[model samples]
Target: METKNITGLTEFILTGLTHQPEWQVPLFLLFWMIYLITIVGNFGLIALICNDPHLHIPMYLFLGNLAFVDTWLSSTVTPKMLLNFFAMSKECKIQFFSFAICVTTECFLLATMAFDRYVAICKPLLYPVIMTNRLCIWLLVLSFLGGLFHAIIHNAFLLRLTFCNSIIVHHFYCDIIPLFKISCTDPTINFLMVFIFAGSIQTFTISIVLVSYTLVLFTILKKKSLQGIRKAFSTCGAHLLSVSLYYGPLLFMYVLPGSAQENDQNMMDSLFYTVIIPFLSPIIYSLRNKKVIDSLTKMLKRNV
Candidate 1:
């Protein structure tokens, strides 16, 4: 028994979104359709950003990053998740790390985008100088680096602990909190690490976004340019929607540990952020931004 415990867990059985077999086909088809839309929308966003000369601004650049991140984020988890709908219990430890990296990167990207909008709206005259090519490049690099550091810290802590049995993971995708709950070790330190990282990241990013938008709002209210205010709302409004969708479920799941939360409810909340948000972001952005709409219209005409 001692030797059996010493071997540690190499693999895990993911119970997936549901334990009932009857729901398999319905969920698979549902996720498959959403995945398809996510792919098309994000790719269309990236392509529009690249092809349109008008979109060669800091705003679009960040949108391109968001689209790219969405593309990879959905791809990283959706394919495997779809497979699991039909495939039997399989090892997913490594994929869990990949998901973590993408989520961290995404958080930073959204915050950076808010900063871009703030500069554009609040400092219209100095926007060009403030968000120059060099600064944009640096900001993008920082966003990726922030994610890398986040993923490393999480893996570093988790790596130190050992698992002796292949346990069932409750959530559909790999999330830090749920994973921590099942760790064979004490996980006390890991739980603390989750709060330190998740709290700091979520709080810092949300603060930046809220502060930027608040400034923009205050500045716009004073301005007499009705057109200017309209444009600001069009762009910033979409961003706020995306931000809310991404963070709302996230806060519910991870801002604080709640033992009272049902595991199924937790998984549903995670699903909204992970799977649903990616599908909706592009639609919300394209609908709100006239430039994106014009670009789509032009492309459609050209193809026709």
Candidate 2:
């Protein structure tokens, strides 16, 4: 029997989205457009938040951080995915850290935004005091640090794995599950870390969002006026939308075992979490939130 202990594998051949040659060019065009739009929209959001004095509050501050992360996350994954789309053999390899950091950061940041929303709605009178400028800055710093810490731990364990057996990764990016599938040695420790951090941490964040929303929901329900309900939903609708777009696919991808995701579905899920969500998040905020729309309109009109 061939020993699986050999550890000299320096590269991996990513299977990308499909084996069908006919689909590559069309898919490339699609993602390329999506990437361009995401870049434009997210950067515009960050700049708008920074420049508009009325928008410089806790919510927008959190949103600016979200926008910045979304911009980089999309940039990090999509460009590389686009590059693979045109590769003649549908083969490419990328650093494991890029996907790790981007996804991990976004997870913590989303949770932090949930907390921000919680302060705004659940404790409306104390919202300003609770989410003060100093606290907001610290929260942002914590989100970044938490994400980097998760990514470092994840990649550190991953770096120890010997992938002497399979160099063909059956997915788009260097996602945790995909790497696990190809690892030659026993991935017990790696799996355990993911179980503890990815599973526990993701669950903890999702719970925070859910619990916060539950309080907001009860508050909205107690109000007899329909307008009060409308107001509540409007305040949180974009957030909920972005959360669903983010957590739905994220839970699907990471929560399950690696083998559960077949190649095609894995690629599509990667495309959604890495590419589509980043694009959709800004649009969700800008189109649905009146303040952002008003701010953007003024800026555009001024430019004109």
Candidate 3:
């Protein structure tokens, strides 16, 4: 990972969400609570899926992995942000690597989940044969490996740039854009890599999601039985909500152009995806999913 002039800057200081002294403690408390809820919610869902025999299908399998990723993703950023509220924090390359991997993997996983829904709804008979155990495992592995590959490519490119300028990062966490802005060496290649790789990943995965859901929607509308149509909507609703919540901020932050005044908006956008989405994911799943709620209730009854 070593490159020219990289040794001198061993660490970078993060300027957290706000510089106001009054807001520090409140921000810490708020995010601390949010972090706790995110961990419990995601992990609780994982445990529920594992313990419940009914949730052993391919959909929940993908969901279990999604929950795991959400936990890791939330941990990657929120803890560091929470810590920054109390004292100065040092940013490292690992933070960037972890965040990139989680975010990239999530993009693929969401697309995979969309495909899973397509199979289940669009082709009910073949759903069983189509979404086999081996295929599900393969999909999971592909999502993870795809993320790893993307992160490795970006990290390799990032290593080429030298940060000889100010070590103070404006954002709460170690993100690629802020790092690129801070580098003394030319980061044009790095920016291109982000646009190309990140853009391609988003475009490809989002295409899959859109196509899959479009098919599912058409299938649902074609169902003559009102009950069947309702069931199909119920099945796909949670996923659609999750996708919207996950992608909306991403599109705003990465795809759209920003101005100097939008720095605060950028922070708010970052906070939404990194903190809010993870916290809300399991809630969306649990509330919208009857099986998950039933499983939780059953577990509580068993213990009580």
Question: What local distance difference test score does each model get?
Answer: 0.83, 0.79, 0.88
- Stretches of model 1 off by over 4 angstroms after superposition: 1-3, 6-10
Point out the higher-scoring one by lDDT: 2 or 3.
Answer: 3
Q: What lDDT tens digits, residue by residue, belong to model 1 across residues 1-304?
A: 5623322344666768876789999999999999999999999999998988999999999999998888888887788778778774556656667777778888989999999999988888999999999999998999888887888887778776665564667767666676677766788888778778888999999999999999999988998989978977888999999998898877777667664798888888878878888899899999999999999899889999
Regions more than 4 Å wrong, model 3: 1-10, 256-261
List the candidates' TM-scores in order: 0.95, 0.92, 0.95
Residues forming the 10-long window of minimal summed lDDT in candidate 2:
87-96
Q: For model 3, how big is the CA root-mean-square deviation?
A: 2.9
lDDT of 2 by residue, 133-184 (tens): 8998898888888777887887677668887656777766656777777787
Q: Model 3 lDDT vs. the true structure?
A: 0.88
Clashes found in each candidate (C-alpha, N, C closer than 3 A): 1, 0, 0
lDDT of 3 at 177: 79
Residues 50-80, model 3: lDDT tens digits: 9999999999999999999999999999999
| Worst 10 contiguous positions by lDDT, candidate 3 | 253-262
RMSD of 2: 2.3
